[model samples]
Target: MRDAYHEELDALTDRLVEMTRLVRSAISRATTALLDSDLQLAESVISHDEEVDRIFAEIEASIFDLMARQQPVAVDLRTIVVALRMGTDLERMGDLAEHVAKVARLRHPDSAIPPEIRSTILEMGQIAERLITKTGSCIASRDVESALELEADDDAMDRLHRRLFKILMADDWKYGVEPAIDVTLIGRYYERYADHAVRVAQDVVYLVTGSRTQDADLR
Candidate 1:
């Protein structure tokens, strides 16, 4: 019975890691769709987002069932609870990716970002991808070092966000109001995506260190 229970826990971990990979793909594809205005790819990202949501629901239900049946304690309880939080964050990240894809779809044939700030937005997308990759690594290996490094990784995204705003607020800005709003919303989507990845990595840190007090920015 104990062996079976442990196996179930391992399966739960696998599900969480899989969700990370799916969301990572979503954001990466969404970024490409945004840059190129690829309607097909944008639709694909939007459609497959349901996979992440389904997994999140599964992880939540499994955690609930495990708690009710096994009464997990100490590290076991911590891992289960953290899995729940991580799944939630990952699902939210997926939704952000979907939102980006929707923006691309809405503006079909025209890129969401203007030429001036395209590079910055591209960099933001790249940083978001890197952070989420490390998030998956932390989940798979329980690498507390990589998990801790995510805070600094997130700072890079923050910097890119500021650069985006500077471009928008420039004295000679000529992109017009609709483009400005699109870029603003795009920048925010990428920033929030990175924030969710950081939250997942922070949860990994909490899982390893057994301290939730360190993460004050989980939102």
Candidate 2:
């Protein structure tokens, strides 16, 4: 029975790793679609969101089953709990990617922001993508130190988000209110994606070190 339980746990971890890969791919493709104004790729990302949702449900069911059957304790219990939390974060990240795709589709061939603002938006997307990839690696490797590094990476995203806002709100604005609103919402989607990735890393830290970190300072 113990050996069977171990096998189930390992399977759960493997499924999570797979889910992480899908979420990362969604982020990458969604960002590329936005930057390149590729409606087809953006549509693909939007359609694939259902797969992420399915994986979330699978992970949750597996965790609940393990808890009821094996009655995990100590580190084992922590692993299950952390897996559920990580799944939630990953799902949210996937949803944010879809949101980016929606924005791209809404704008179609033309980008919502001008060239200057588009550049800033691209930079924000890149930072968010990097953090998402690193957070996945930290979780898979169970590297507490690397997880802490992700916190700093998230800080960079926050800085870029604020910078983008400052540019949007400046008195020199020429894009008009509608374009400004689109760009602002896109920046928000990217920022929220990074925020959830940071949360996943924090959950990993809790799993390994048994403690939670400070809440993100949104100011």
**TM-score per candidate, chains pooled:** 0.95, 0.93
Candidate 1 accuracy as TM-score: 0.95
Report how far residue 108 has shifted in candidate 2, in Å.
0.3
Candidate 1 weakest lDDT stretch, 10 residues: 210-219
Candidate 2 structure quality by residue, lDDT tens digits, 90-163: 89989999998888888989876677777777777778878877887877788888877877777888888988
lDDT of 1 by residue, 75-122 (tens): 999899889989999999999999999999999997877889879878
Task: Point out where model 1 deviates above 4 Å.
Answer: 213-219
Q: Flag regions of model 2 displaced more than 4 Å.
A: 213-219
Best by lDDT: 1
C-alpha lDDT (0 to 100) for residue 193 of candidate 1: 92
Give the winner by TM-score.
1
Q: What residue pairs are clashing in model 2?
A: none
lDDT agreement of model 1 with the native: 0.90
